[model samples]
Target: MTRDLLSPAHTGCLQDFSSRYTRTCRLDAEQVQSLLYVLGTTLKANLNRSAPPKTKYFSVKCTDNVQYIISPLPQASSYLSPVRLKDNSVLLITMKEASTQENDNKLSVWYYAANKKVLDKAILHLTAVDISLDVDADRDGFVEKNNPNKNAWKWGPRGHGAVVLVNCDSETLYRRKPDYKRERILKSSDVKDMSPMVLRTKGPPKLPEGYKLVLHISQSDGENIRVFITSGERYPLVLNSEVLSKEIPYLGTDEIMFYVEGVSFPDKDFDGLVHINLSLLEPIGEGIPETPIFTDTVVFRVAPWIMTPNTLEPVEVFVCSTKDNYKFLSSMQSLVDRCGYKLNICYEYMNRGDRWMQDELEFGYIDSPHHSFPVVLDSPRNGKLDDFPYDVLLGPDFGYVTRVPSRKDVSSLDSFGNLEVSPPVTVNGKHYPLGRIIIGVAFPTASKGRNMTKMVQNFLWAQTVQEPIALYSDWLEVGHVDEFMSFVPAKDRKGFRLLLASPDAGYKLFKNLQNDGHGDAMLFEEIPDQDSISVNEILDDKQLQAENNYVQSCIDWNRDVLKRELGLDDEDIIDLPILFKLLEYRGQYRAAAYYPDMVNLIVLGRNLGIPKPFGPQVNGVCALEQEMVSLMGNLGLTCTFIDDFASYHKLLGEVHCGSNVRRAPFDFKWWNIEM
Candidate 1:
């Protein structure tokens, strides 16, 4: 029977049995022979007792329903018998009686060790099913379980049978077979963990008041990390931490933290967000990758304290009151009243021949008053003068009375007979050492070569103070820094903006007027009939070429120096179109004068006081005044035009020199500021 079952002629039968069982079963020839012998003996015994004398062989019919239901049970089942083969090996076979409902109709063909100790050490391989096994080692009531999610098989208290079962859902069994194979492959492969995690941060949404802002960073084990805050390109605030000495903080581990310090609200109202950036750098010797290792930005909203300008003490306007300037006093007084500012009229009188009350000579210049004064919260000089000294005066005859409070003290003179001492000027309740600041001087040819020794000494003195004085061309009769450049509060309220006189724009206006045939009128209208000359007579082509070259050189030099000193860009400057005229001074030497001196306008807080240009109208318009007013309006400034043609402009002076401002003290401590 074993030979017949193993023959090629019975291959179809074997396949049919396997199909019905729905599982593959491997059997040795000995096990097949035993099964056949048991069936044969039982059939012969039953047939002999029931059949008549003619019944030599018994016939059996296999029904499809019975065949399908009578499938093999697991080898560990109690009904399975162990056959000891002639080779001394045991073959476990499930009997037909083992196919019962209690078995869950599951065919468990895999074998297991009967001994509890042997079964405990045995390995059971499975794909997706979570498996478990239990053994009663001492025949005790307690059964030890393993792999709890898998089916459990209970051995009798005597530890008679050892069972193994694999349980899993149909979907998991089908899906996880490939995954299990891949996991085996992965475990065998030698691969390094090269991918590092990104840096992350957890912190408060808003910064706390009067306390350091703390932030926690997720652990970055091996990479170098850096963090900082930025407001575009301007470096204003400081970022400090134990790990950093500069703006960028470097960290070896994420456990360390950093903070921002010296952060203050802007002078004006500002509500916005600032970005904090975290950067991670790859380990050294790791070549540059296609992209940066890691970069992340976190935004935080800021609400800073609000402050208003001090109103108890307002800015003051100072003007020289030489005898000739007395006529314009009423207009100045009216302007002060309208703008709600205090007016200080310096009445010190001085005579320097015919040009004594010239605006450039008398007014004097103050560049940055904030840096010059000492701040005090409460005092008579809360924002005003501290002390006035006489020996420190700049000059004697050069002093217009409004400039000098003491006349009896004569200061030592330089080679050109110019006073050499630096004076103390009072503004906003504080006194500044004028000697320490570099003063801009414009010495005419008469004063230049006449006293080279004294001039060099003055220059050395200026250098010794670490403030190299700026010396512009003195071609103009009233050449002065105030005549061409003035400082106005910036729109952002951070600092002041420099207002420059744009000669290029002025030349364009002149060209336009000339093309329209109004050039002669602009040149001759201001002069008397006897003295009037045509534009051509005043400046031939050769003279005009020289003048253009001179003006361009002056403009370029001034612009470059101002930008270097003030750290200004083009955006920080406002250019006002202003034309210059060549004129004979005392019929001996030639001099230049700005036709309108637009930059010479006065600033009173947010308001401006400008001079109304008085000259020939071009194309039915006073182009200078029209342009100045239009530009001021566009700048968001309220302007008041005061007529200074007869009083100031005719004397080679303009509005700024005729008046000054003791601007309001800023709320911030200037001394604490880093330059």
Candidate 2:
């Protein structure tokens, strides 16, 4: 700061040259080594506060090691040019010669007073530091130096931003909690999940007495993320709130490495983008608090969890072996073996008689440039299988996530069977390379029907990769979308087909059987407890026909929704011959499978595990099986009828409802999609 001296006799204002105070400036080593360095800047502040200073002539005087630097001149002028300091001007200086080691430097200047006869000089102190903050914002796998846009995010192939993976995967099975839930990294693999940040500093072995560098995160970001600095044995967590920040002394010749791990996922509450900052604080006065002279920043966005569809490659199939489902388990084992995929069976000990494995969890995986792994999305429906995912499936590279709403909101619609995904689709020119998620909810106009819990829906919607579309499933007694609709692989036309259970198809198949003189072929003729009904008897039941008409209307409403939302054509659908019967639930009528729901089947590669539909036997084989084979035969699919008649269908579910599958993730990278 400079002050003026004015007297009536002199009638002139005091200029900065009249002051004896010295100006000291510090430049980083990188800046000093450049062709030109900005030593200081001058600008007009407020005209109302103070008048602008007049341009003053100046002469530079400095040590031999450093000199006033300027842009290269034209060939016409090689002589030293006169220097002047004015409003909105930059004083450029640089090292006289390049040097690898630290250099003690100084620069001085003399300026003429208003009298034009007197001269005064001021000393300018100079120093250089090797402080460079770096991050992989460009995603080129190498840390870039001091980029101005490091703290911002950009999308697409040419964008720039660091990536952070949700530390959702586990590295150890000995621990009961997930790896993300642990306070510290459990193994070397856990460290691989974080983004690398480097603070490269080189100077004297120690910083000047009162200078230090501190790393920190904002308070809001601190809650959803954690940062660690690599030391000897332990990577000390810096953003642990107890300290909230960590100070790095002069690294001398070493670099400080920091790893950022996302503790929370992208949801309604968190936006998925996080920031980490580094500041250089300087000591001004002995007792004065240090001031932050320089700051650097880097940003990251948590990767969204992605769901795999049935059309993708199958990794494995999971089913619970209950007390009454032995026949179903055997059928599933044969189907899995024939398909050449692994089978994971949860026996009675852990399942505790809860047979609906599809209701318990959905399989998804989070991904980033650093790492990716399968993360099981546990549903709010807390059946006896609640502990199965957390206890068994969570180990090594596997991850776990769950949303538990209030018990009052929990319903059958909250089950994972209510959750499904279409194959990759392009709706309205917008492509979904990973496919879109499907969920069951009450009809939009209905006020008293059941819907999937809001908390679970929020969690699913936050996974922006595969945006979800809701279908009406409250018409069914169990309120699951899978009870009426599914997806399977196909050779052509979008690579998959939307399968829907059609009561019209069921009646048409039966009428053909009756016309073929198979009317006496009884439905449930020899089945254990079902009363036999002739095809003619079924055709004469006007009330049954009326209920089926109502059920067909419900199915058609969803059929239109699926066609519109998934960009499906009429040719893309396969209507299976399955019928539903309405029953009184509470005060409203909801439909349940009249026989085994053939559409609620598991699709593994080209193999299908359909629930055995106990229909009228016109020949040695069941007519329903023959009809299903005919429908799927054109697609080069094989049908394996799983006899879940008493174990699953009688209990108001079918094959897909009781079994779950974990398929391989898409080969496409999720981050490349334009959001």
Candidate 3:
């Protein structure tokens, strides 16, 4: 007969119903119960072995009537019955005494002992130590020693060996005396007893209203600690506690007000007298507030008194800001110029919004009001708002707003306008209000010499300003200055320089300077402001395009005269076109580096193709073009001169009269012109 352990659902069944003697098994109440008990125990054992391991702790109950079943049970089951066997270590935290005036005035110490007997012996030695005999012991310094046991004092050696002590002065000591004096301090007592305290006062303990006092106890050392607090005071009462000292509230004045006190238990060294002065509390709070309670958190750490002595010279300039913008506005040069007084700025990065600034204006009453940017003045007396002038040199009528997309072909005239060629003192496309006309100049290429200068003058004259003339140049493209470079020169010229290798309009200007022995005037470099990054490349491209266009315009103008007015013919026009092409494309790429002598060849080889207007004329045209290009290059000027505007205008008129109407401003039909 084999026993099967795995099968729970299968059981022995009656086979061949008519086998009377073979079915000798008992089916009575006691037999059934006994068999079930055995089966249940065996099944439970097997199931327990097969079940996977559980990681958490659990409570289990076993009963004789209850069969082994994996199912939920009620809470009142026998499993929940209490059965204690082993004892565990316990910690006792006790408050020994409240902090009264006597305790508050003294330095306190708490001692730990294993048992009452050890504590008694320690107390006896401590009481007899004669702490005064120690070197440098202050007779006046207050000192108090406390132990856990109340009965241990009786066993302590009296007179000389008493362990517990108390005092009400400064620098009191607790010393351990020599063995010879131990007997003298110790009392010969057969049983335990108690003693008393020295210098008893006549008054009862006094505490402020709403303060529930308690003595804190250290678990490991059994040291007792205590501190008192009023209703609103949240002081640190625990030793070695983490303490955070908060700022006191300001009472609405330049003299800031804040209270000092500890507010935690873990830090023990938080006791110090804070003088509570304005300068010391400068960095304490956030900016001003709308309501008294809406001020910023006034928490800060103050160094020792020596670090901020009372005799320290008061700063002339009172620095303050409601917004966080002034955080990085502390450069020494800016400080001297912007703030009239010495550096006395409160460095608190409080984000209180508009109300902060409003409060500053009310409380600080600074002469100049600073919102997003500082309102700096040339002098302290000039801080009056009226002293500074509005940036309206261009005047009202002359102003125009146009969103000129940054283009390679056009230089942005100003933040709000675009430029077209014009002359000086043209008032709004009408009259010439020739007062002192101030013209502003800005460009990526500073070496443009008199060309840009004259161009700016031309733009101003086209605007027609009726004021005295004041010409300004932005030498530096500072971020803000880049937008208003044409209007104000004082703030923008710091970084201005004539970049020789700028590869823009400056290229032509640089060449001119090199030819004229004034190249040194244009060569300069400086770090550009970060905010001007967008305009940097855009302006550079514009400058390059303008330079190229100027060159082409000059060549086209000269060619027109040489062909039509001077009657030079088609060969002459072709040759001039070649010259312009050579001048523009000669040093374009790696080819120039290889063929360095090509410039000289082109200069000497240039000659007209033929005198005929439409005949075969490649050689003469190519030769003439080379000569003209080389000659132009040697001059170091990109043919920007507008010598005959009137003649050009007349020729355009004749062309327009005979030409067909076209959609584009410049587009026209040659047939129409001929007709």
What are the models' TM-scores? 0.38, 0.88, 0.13
The deviation in Å at residue 66 for candidate 1 is 99
Cα lDDT listed for each candidate: 0.35, 0.76, 0.19
- Which predicted model would earn the best lDDT? 2
Ranking by lDDT: 2, 1, 3
Winning candidate number (TM-score):
2
lDDT of 3 by residue, 1-675 (tens): 221221111112112111111111111211111111100011112112211233111222222122222112223332333111112211111111222231221111111122211111000000000000010011112212211121111111121111111110111113322111111212212001111111111111422212111112223222211111112333222221221222222111112111121111111232111111111111122563211101111111111000110011212323233243332223322433432333333333332221111111100000000001011111111112111111211111111111122233223123111111111122233332111222234323545311122322333333222222322223212111111111100112221111111122223533443465533331101112212211123224554445445434433443443233222333222122111111222332100100011111100011101111111113333222233345444433121111111211112111111111001111111111110
Runs off by more than 4 Å, candidate 2: 1-55, 60-79, 92-103, 113-118, 140-149
> Which parts of model 1 are misplaced by more than 4 Å?
1-314, 320-327, 346-438, 441-475, 492-495, 515-545, 581-591, 618-620
TM-score of 2: 0.88
Model 2 C-alpha RMSD to native: 7.4
Residue lDDT tens for model 1, 210-261: 2121222322200112233332332222222223323233221222222221
Q: Give, for candidate 2, the lowest lDDT window spanning 10 residues.
A: 41-50
Write the residue-wise lDDT of candidate 2 on 189-232 in tens digits: 67787778888765556655677788877787887778887887
Q: What does the lDDT come to for candidate 2?
A: 0.76
